[model samples]
Target: MAERYAISSGSAYEEKYGYARAVVDGDRVHVSGTTGFDYATMTISDDVAEQAEQCLRTIDAALTEAGGSIADVVRVRYLLPDGADFEACAPVLSRWFGAVRPAATMMVVGLLDPRMKIEIEAEARLTR
Candidate 1:
């Protein structure tokens, strides 16, 4: 079995939830559902597009720390409470993933925090 490594974004929730933001085992890195809240400032934007961008930023940071890049992502999952909000986030999603074109799934689901407009999770394989 490969050794497991945990990555942290220093978000308060990680401590409360008892889970790392991302984890690495061998060549693959699995990032947990990331939200729009900026962990550093603990602030979340009301705009869905902005929230989507923040989700990608948080995911990318975790991937980078795990020795991968957004380009290495093989899968992505998006969660939004409102189905209509999906359209608002398409451009932001495209901005980060338009070229990579990883396998993706988007669904309408209620998040733990009502202030959260979007949540994103990703998986990446390290490439040397």
Candidate 2:
């Protein structure tokens, strides 16, 4: 069986929840749902576009640690607290993913944290 590995960057969630930010098994890397908070301050921005940018930054770090890159991403799932914010945030997301164009889904849902406007999760493959 292929070995499994977990990666983290000492974020509070990993320390408090006892979970790695991401796990890699075989060729697949599964990243946890990431919010738009700056870890240094544990603060989330109110602007939807800024929040989306923060989420993608975190995802990028997680992917890099898992030996993958954004280009290797095969899927992305976005959760937005308000449906109306989709248009406001879509351009930001598209700018980040313009070149890669991975499979993606976006949905409006009630977030666990009321202050959070967006959350992002991703899956990537490490090619041989």
Model 2: number of backbone collisions: 0
102 Cα displacement, candidate 1 (Å): 0.7
Task: Write the residue-wise lDDT of candidate 2 on 22-72 in tens digits.
Answer: 899989989888889887688899898899899888888888877778788
TM-scores of all predicted structures: 0.97, 0.90
Task: Determine the backbone clash count of candidate 1.
Answer: 0
Summed backbone clashes in each candidate are 0, 0
Residue 29 lDDT, candidate 2, scale 0-100:
89
**Model 2 TM-score, all chains together:** 0.90
Give stretches of model 2 more than 4 Å off. none
Q: Which ten residues in a row have the lowest lDDT in candidate 2?
A: 8-17
Worst 10 residues of 1 by lDDT: 119-128
Model 1 lDDT at residue 34: 97
lDDT of every model, 2 decimals: 0.94, 0.86
Work out candidate 2's RMSD over C-alphas.
1.5
Question: Can you list the residue pairs that collide in candidate 1?
Answer: none
lDDT of 1: 0.94
